[model samples]
Target: MTGYTRASALGPITEFVETRGGSIERIFRRVDLPLALLDNPDLPLPLREQFKVLREAGREIGDPFFGAALGRVVSMKKLSAFGAWVSGAPTLAGAIDRSGRGLNRFLQTATVLRFQVSEAKARWSIEFLDPGKDGRFQNELLGVSYLIDGVRHYAGSGWTPTLIRSTCVGAEQAAALENVFQAPVLHDAPVSAVEFDTALLSATGPERKQPDFGAEPPIPPPVGLREEVAMLSTIALLEGSPRIDWVARKLDMSRRSLQRALDREGCSFSTVLEGLLKDRAVALLLAQKRSLTDIALHLGYSDSAHFSRAFRRWTGMPPSRYRS
Candidate 1:
């Protein structure tokens, strides 16, 4: 499974396409995606569909640099919750670390951001654990853009990376990206990354006004089987396909023992796994951007027929009708 991404990630490209004499509806239709999903910027769209949309949009707009062009216009305000969490951090390094750790929460099962710190520089890179069939050019471009934009929010607009490296860009595309990033972009690098001075990590930005969600309270630690299972499930999903045996091994117990523990907690292993799958399925369907076949493969189903039957049992409706 490629997991999912917020719809706002596609905002800049959508706007760019629309402004350049392209129809948003036509683009979505061409990709077999629902146009209505665009209305909710915070909704989660399957990552695979995001790639398809960008690739199709590039073809539609007749520009090979469409992704890079779109990246130039993206701002942190467009990233929603992930942006908020990044913006609220106290320091540049803290923000980068927070974004890397919490990325899976906002993007569901995807965790492609990697951060490394040394005496001289801080390197942040994106290398998908599973690249899948589609190339990662657009995703890499958008990721670099988002990192630059988010860092600028804290490090000031004048901040630039020491260097930018991307695996997908060519000499021509790299030149265009250089104009946007205002720095040298190395084409055909080992990975897509931004290298920054380590000293800047401690630099502070203007104080952000905290939201009035509520008063702060003491935080409690996660305790019990449910929390453990949930945490393990998330790890399994992000790393690859989730399996009961793998989870049991992680827990250092036999599958029977794990099931008995969950049973004592008034839940079965299948029940918990099914619940997580159902939640993920609903999010994908509400986005209305992926076919049943794609969704099935994402959920680790061997085939769509089995996935359809399970989905029907879970929701009492077909996956297609559920989206409708």
Candidate 2:
């Protein structure tokens, strides 16, 4: 596993941007984003730029979870449609039942959906889908933050998550994820998750109400945000140094177009990829007890020396010195 989860909540980012007087056309041009994308709410924008846009204008959006801000505006269209088909049949539980979509039709870019459920608890997780190492935990935190708003909207109340769990262990403690979720966030236990108490399942469909939580403001609508994120994902996708062809295929862009996109974003593909690779290397070395040689292999270095040279170039020191 790449140890990543896909964040599909980005479907509404455009709308969020537009709402805040962010220039859609200027943003499109600025970000090297095509205006045609606005028509296709289901389109997957690039990931690197997406993170940049989110982090760049994050505070303005009144959301810490970049993806969640988008999810706040999205209605689970598939689930809503399915629920409407069985309208007023019985409780909200009956209306929704247990139908699941492999893709959460509600999200376009972020790839997440409700995968499973229990009698009282529904367990759904978004693959962080991070190429940079350790976005897993941050991504999970962002997802939960978004879910808080989402659950409240559908549940028609300020429904808090009963529990939270993560594989982050000591790291999650450093992040204080509980402050974001405002629920019991359990670390080093199992998978990252947000748990709803049993009664939420039975809430009727029509009975579902949106929360009083006012939506956040729009962030800067840079066109390149999605493209930036896509590049980041591509960098993360490659095991080590990646070829232009591989990145082009992953981004569904021609080599020339990819180059142009990077230029427009004021970045180069190689520069960005090198940064992410080094970042991942440093993160893995710091977070895990794995030996240096093992870390080198995981990063796709043939031997420790090669990785050491690259690591030194990326950082100022060899991996061992950094660890110490």
Candidate 3:
């Protein structure tokens, strides 16, 4: 199942490689990949090819923990649509759930994201459907680091996994992972995963006032009421009209019941709608690819002026200045 992934998956590492004194061009050429892949993040690269580049980058840079370093620097914004979509989730567990479901949607295929809980521990893991485990050490470490980061988003940045499990063996490799994760790493494991306390799963995410980038791809069916509201609201926003009643009807609940449920979770339909708007607005502005009138209309504003006013209220500046 060597499927495909976006070239943007390399964006974070591309810069990191250069900073570490590795020539990305040489690495790509050595791996038989096109140099243009770096220029276009949305371009599709064979998943195996991406793995090869990662291994080559670590080898050339002589950084045994290169993948771990790369993972630590991965920001949600750099993930494009996938990141934006995950950021909308209300809790750490919800975000992981979204990633497990939406990874194939916004990023790649032939991969499985697994979240499991046993007793007092929770494990989150990523695995390729492909059979061989031979050249995937770096990729697995990167995946592990990414999972840790997701937990850190809510559990606080200083959070560390209770344990790290990896397919990579050897004391040296285990030591490398230990250095990066600052936790005990079990080598020669059947799967690569991070284990943490089950209690952390309930950590609430930060209020999403502004999103770094956005794209409203269809969200998978969500598990929580808050997430369901967010999903329906995104759909309504794309239809150019966001209304709570429509979402309530879709959920087979009365509008008042939905509001009370959201209140219990300390969320409201208006808040969800505003966050979605801000996400889309910032994404479009950052793209520098559309007119204010067009963006206003797309966001269901009466005109650019009204949109500008709302943008100012959300942000400190007007749309034109913000874009500039």
Q: For each candidate, what is the lDDT?
A: 0.71, 0.52, 0.77
lDDT of 2 by residue, 24-132 (tens): 4554455444354444333334444455445433444444553434444544432233323333324434433422332223222333435357776776554444353
Model 3, residue 127: displacement in angstroms? 0.5
Q: Write the number of the candidate with greater TM-score, choosing between 1 and 3.
A: 3
Q: Which candidate should be chosen as best, given TM-score against the real structure?
A: 3
lDDT of 2 at 280: 71
Stretches > 4 Å off in candidate 1? 169-172, 207-324
Q: What TM-score goes with each of the models?
A: 0.63, 0.43, 0.63
RMSD of 1: 11.0
Model 1 C-alpha lDDT per residue in residues 177-215, reported as the tens digit of each score: 788678989999977898888888887656453422132
For each of the candidates, the C-alpha root-mean-square deviation to the true structure, in angstroms, is 11.0, 19.0, 15.5
The TM-score of candidate 1 is 0.63
For 1-324, candidate 3 gives per-residue lDDT tens digits of: 445567778777788899888898888768645566566566544466667778889988898667787888886534776776676678888888888877876687667889899999999988887443434778887878777787888788788889988877788888877887788998998778989999998898774433333543332434467766775565456547577877786555899999999999898888888888998899999999999999999899999999999999999899999999
- After best superposition, candidate 3 residue 260: deviation in angstroms? 62
